[model samples]
Target: MTAHLPASGTPGADLGAAVRALPKVLLHDHLDGGLRPATVVDLAAQTGHVLPTTDPEALGRWFVESAASGSLERYLETFAHTVGVLQTADALRRVAREAVLDLAADGVVHAEERYAPEQHQRGGLSLQEVVDAVRGGLDEGMAQARSAGDDIRVTQVLCAMRQGDRADEVAALALANRDAGVVAFDLAGPEEGFPPSRHASAFRTLRDASFPVTVHAGEAAGLASIGDAVHRAGALRLGHGVRIADDVHVGPGGEVRLGRLAHWVRDRRLALEVCPSSNVQTGAARSVAEHPVTMLLRLGFEVTVSTDNRLQSGTSPSRELELLVREAGWTHDDLVAVTVAAARHAFLQEDERRALVDRIVRPAVSPGTARPGRHRA
Candidate 1:
């Protein structure tokens, strides 16, 4: 392990620039939730989908403001336009391609972009077709990035909407496409009333096949939802698992005591994909500084930072780290810690993750690693 670096001089413009230049790994980004504003405008025009405004700039503002509603249910409603335009294979392909390029430009070296395949079937495409289109787009973007002197590895995680009834079908689709870049299966959409146990058969099928699993839990709901994801759904990772903080108690002297559930999560080293800006918009946390991610990190839970939805949140992996440094008092060491955690917990095979940490991430953040002098400050 590299020796921890002390806090950089200041946490303003210089720090933001440094954070943006650091290499990053993303584990919880959503495909449908990260379309570029201009792309949305162009696709909506092609599909004859009406929008709040056709101008790309105003449309971007609309998404951010609409999602700013403090209710997760309301925040999700803003996706109607993004998903509406993404019904065609071409639209899905373009969005996936651009998403990869965007993440790469922001210094992300590895990303797993997820989406529910069932959502894109409204245009009469089969699930396999949808997967193929996205894979093609990712390949195109990867090739383009390499030509531009950047290298990135992007993969897919198939999601089954919890509010829908096609978990078994989605699981089968994931299994069929596993070797074709689909790395894992997940349950997304409203986490309040829908528990992962509802799709027990799907999870059992994947487990029997030795497939990896992740679940969106402890975000819109509380401990029971998280418990179901861990014990019943067998999730190797939790999407926005910030609510695990509910089970942790602090004493008058500031000593921390972990409840049984918290102990299980921490002791087992289950990674929590904490998206701070998105969490505040959904009322999951009061602010970035107050978010349980910092406390969870201090208490030894495996905590990783991510941008859950780039478009709606108006953020990237770099911007997400900048916010944490600016508001949560995170040092360079803290940023490096989360980056290492994300790489280790990514849904890759052990050798792949090890290579990513050893060859890419560690070299980027180590002391005296050459970066732009302007960013080094």
Candidate 2:
């Protein structure tokens, strides 16, 4: 079902307020990609990691500008500084804690933040230590959020860099920590050369263990990569799967047809973690208005909006939804639909997903209470 706001005229300020008040579910946030600008400066100073600028605001702007280079490869190069300072357990904990708090403040009720654990070993810490530290930070952030009257649940999706040869080791790490805090496994990093098939053993391990797996597919690559992710790697979800639109054709008669792969994804309801701003920055789409997410959503794909890299995109879930409302003509209904879809497809068990929708999402977006601008909670 779709929802709509008043059609005549709505101020942007009012629209932004309603979007912020709606409870959000985030499935594609990146821990290392969403660090606070000031925190990055402080951590860089402590670790002696040189940055483009020492000033927090300038560093933040530099990240946005560098990531907006319109090439995914160049966009990813901005991560070196973030990964550079995040080599210590203490650094990971601080970043994780801040990520939860920041998401909660942005009105996210449930979130799955991911990071590549193998990337944090420069400080001589074990993979287990990295997971432990991040889990500790998530716990700490949740506790603090509760004290402040914010209800939020954050968990980890451990990722193995597809370009690296440690997929097997990282898969083992995810399985070992599954019961503790890790909820799923992921294959991340460049997708052009390092296809999901390269991590076949890791996916096998995860599938045998019945652990959830999401792959960074259909972003920098095309249909073949996404095909490999779903068919070969057994991915349950696609990270930045916007490129799946390549398989969808819209005719001049206003009719739409889906290619076999697109049909498979939509028919099976494989969630697409579409981050509009990040997609635009990386040249996946021209802009939010032109992003395939809106079309895919209308076409009945289980589309979910997210802030892939909050810092790099300079976005929040609320902001992403607002962009759709203003640019792509999304209404409150579209916002709520994506939120519920995210909750439904989250890595948690079925009962937990239901509870998240009922206790968090439904109450905020319910009719008569979710009107624009006036529904601040």
Measured with C-alpha atoms, the lDDT of residue 295 in candidate 2 is 92
Best by lDDT: 1
Per-residue lDDT of 233 in model 2: 92
lDDT of each: 0.89, 0.89
Itemize residue pairs with steric clashes in candidate 1.
none
Poorly placed runs, candidate 2 (over 4 Å): 1-12, 367-377
**Mind giving the per-residue lDDT tens digits that candidate 2 earns over 12-56?**
456766666677899999999999999999999998999999999
Candidate 2 has an lDDT of 0.89
Candidate 2: TM-score? Answer: 0.95
